[model samples]
Target: MCGIVGAVSQKDIVPILIEGLKRLEYRGYDSCGVAVHQDGQLRRARSTSRVAELQDLAAQDGVAAGTGIAHTRWATHGAPAVHNAHPHFSHGPGVDAPQGPGRVALVHNGIIENHDELRAELKAHGYVFLSQTDTEVIAHLVDLLYQGDLLDAVQQAVARLKGAYAIAVFHRDEPHRVIGAREGSPLVLGVGRDEHAGAFFLASDAMALAGVTDQIVYLEEGDVVDLQLGRYWITARGEVTGRFQSVVREVRTVHAHSGAAELGPYRHYMQKEIFEQPVAIANTLDAVTGISPELFGDGAYRVFKDIDNVLILACGTSYYAGSTAKYWLESIAKIPTSVEIASEYRYRDSVPNPRTLVVTISQSGETADTLAALKHARSLGMLHTMTVCNVSTSAMVRECALSFITRAGAEIGVASTKAFTTQLVGLFLLTLALAQTRGHLTEEQEAEHLKALRHLPVAVQAVLALEPQVIAWSEEFARKENALFLGRGLHYPIALEGALKLKEISYIHAEAYPAGELKHGPLALVTAQMPVVTVAPNDALLEKLKSNMQEVRARGGELFVFADGDTRIESEPGLHVIRMPEHYGALSPILHVVPLQLLAYHTACARGTDVDKPRNLAKSVTVE
Candidate 1:
């Protein structure tokens, strides 16, 4: 995934572009660049380093302009290098001419699937290629298609293209003008406020335009936008006609969490997010005074009654959240549930049921694979769709029939903490809603669940108070290269999430299995060097999980367990126990996961890894 930010303004926009890129740093990037129309010439600066380095380079090069496009590229078609960085230039048929500011400069996000064919076609027209990026082909294509109007050129260029992409382009001659388009990938238009009024911006995420603008228009699929000083217009590809038509997309006032992006009292965003879970969960549940199906949407009750089973589509951490929900949905709601990895679900042939409710989970809700899977499900006649997402204006929320917006705010950390926990809270509420609709929940049970949900903030705060204990355990875990996590029943997915968190941030190799399956295979990997992390909640399977812990101990494996205070799991030789404040029954996963997140965070800190921006990962998977 990559980050794109463009500005059309009366003031010098170099700083705004750099600041927007900085806000998007959490989206993960290897190379960054910015191009601007300056003094009747296209001036640009690029670096194969962080945005800060690119900012310095821009300052040193004195690259400043009121209209510009910038990008933080995560390598796709080419290796991470200065030549491969974005803001690609098209010199325009000057194959042998001296290097000069010629025509167009463009930045793109997502892959151009037919770039090779397009590149070959452009080469025949004497448009020399400079970089090994698909984005470069787009720039040269726009240059060749420029008949005068930059908007027309971009439209023609995109017409010849294939694959998912969001692009922003500005021509050398078209001053104070930027043209942006979105096919399958995400792009938004930010209308500036106060003193910055009359300025318009384009960004991949609303977070990129935070503080600069609160009014945002989420560009839909196959939409093109043209932005000038104080005006903008949009055109959308018609569904049946396959032709672009003028359309109006709703603009919503969103308060992007610019303050949340700041790491004030914490060392990293991951650490800050881990500590923000209590408030995040509380805010997510703030709208609910009592359990009701309407919590999802206006007609959720009818949809819930019509659905016979639940099909959850998601990827990565969100997928694991869905896996955890499968237990709650089936056991508590008496509904058959299936969790499918979004990338895999669309390719396989399977029987589809119209009565099945398709629920998609995503933190950013712009995840390309999940969005594609949602569309695939809709194509199969499963039109009853819902999304449990953080961003209210995300594509997932807009496409789904119903949505429950989480209050996790802006999760900057690549390894999710608050987002995952908040999603579980939302899924839990969904389970209760379905249970009530199915007549499996009584009024007393509903009140009980509601009370527990209300107290989640306090319960999570207790778990967070154990951060010191987790930090102590992190010292031992930092030295470990391999780990094994074990749990049973409802807690198994939490163990998997723990293992995922450990591997994601600490760069440690970790695996998780149900406690009952330990002797089946995973026990073979247990040794004195292997550290076993167990989620030992005081549930029905506690005794069985204790037996699994003993199997590890007998193999000389060191054990680190997060257990309930009443579980009576004491600390001993080769066995380290951290007692939880209370046994939270059904909500134990939310509490148990907090300490595991802390362990991963502190272990990454101990090993001096990039806890916020893990290598080879991005906060939002906007590309497949």
Candidate 2:
């Protein structure tokens, strides 16, 4: 995943581009660069460093321009270096075009799958490449096609591309405009004060243009947009067939906050997001004054009535949320449920049911694999599609027939704390809606569920109070190299999430298993050196979970347990237990995960690792 920001303004845009890149840094990138048209030529500065470093480099090089494009690149075709950094340029096809030196400068996101073939063709046409990136080919290709009209040349050049990409192109010959195109990738346009009197902006996400401008337009797939100093237009294209058609779409305002992502009192975004769960959950449920099918979207009741089963598609943390929802769906709604890792689901052949309600869960909602999987499911005639996502303008929300927008704000942490919890909140609502529609939920059951939902924020706050205890446990955890987490019944997915949080932030090798699965070979790895963390909720499976804990204890394994107060698990010499003040029953996973998040946060702090922006991790997985 990479981030792109471009602007055409009358004012110097170097600082604006740098600030935009800093905001989009959570998208994850190895190097940063910026290119601007100034002094009748193109000026650029690139760095194999953070955006701040790139800012300093640009300032040192005295590079400033009013109209420019910036990029924060996550290496795809080549290793991370100055040469591979974006804002790549191309002169043209011939020696005379090379003398121009700044015929084209472009910043691109996503992989060009057919770049190798295009590279060979361009090389044969006397085009020389300066970077080992698939993106550089676009610069040359656009340059070769440029005959004066930048937007038309860009449209023609992108017509030859395959795979996902969101790019902003700048041509020295047409310095007044910035051309942006997206196919299977995310792109947005920002409208300034006026259509013809102010600057126009283009970025991969609204976050990049948040403080700069709140009026945002999300570009659909195969849409090429033009951003001029005071005017902009969009041309929507179709890649389904070989022929391309262009149509203009409307501009929509994005309700986003540039300040919400600030760490404020917290040291890291993970911690801030962890503490924000109470607020996030409340916001996610705020629209549900009383649960109904409309809470998801209009006509959701129709989709629920027609569906006989549920198929959830997601990846990583979102997948775990879906996995947790499977228990709620089958038990409450009486609907058979299946959860699939989106990446694996698309590649494998499986039985398809037209009556299956396909639900996709994602934080960013632009996850490439999950989006592809949704399309794959659609192609199989499963038309009932719904998404539980935080970002409202994301492709998942736009492409789905229905959607529930989670108000998790902005999750800047790469490990994902609040987003996961908020997703569970949305999924629980969906479960209740389906159950109510099927008459599976009685009046009393509905009222009780509503009360529990209303009290979830308070329950999560109570769990956050146990942070000091969890932090104490984390001190010992930081000394370990491997970990195993255990949970029973509905909480098994929570155990998996705990293990994921540990490994993702602390870099410790961790694994999770259903408590009953200990006899199936995971127990063999349980030694004194390996710490076993167990989720002991006061549910029907508490007795069985105790038995599993006993198995681990018998193996001389150190045990760290997060147990409900009524679980009857006392702390002993070899057995460590952090008691949950209350038993949250069906919604226990939302409460149980808070301490695990604190554990991961403190453990990462103890290990001096980057808790918020972990190594080799991006907050948004825009690519497969």
Predicted structure with the largest TM-score when compared to the true one: 1
Give all TM-scores, in the order shown.
0.98, 0.97
Q: What is the lDDT of residue 612 in candidate 1?
A: 83
- Give stretches of model 2 more than 4 Å off: 93-100, 194-196, 238-246
- Candidate 1 local lDDT, 361-465, one digit each (tens): 999999999999999999999999999999998999999999999999889999988999999999999999999999999999999999999999999998889
Q: After superposing candidate 1, which stretches have Cα over 4 Å from the reference?
A: 95-99
Candidate 2 collision pairs: none
Task: Show pairs that collide, candidate 1.
Answer: none
For model 2 the local lDDT of residue 410 reads 90
For 258-360, candidate 2 gives per-residue lDDT tens digits of 8886879889888999999999999998878887999988899898999999999999999999999999999998899999999999999999999999999
Clashes of each: 0, 0
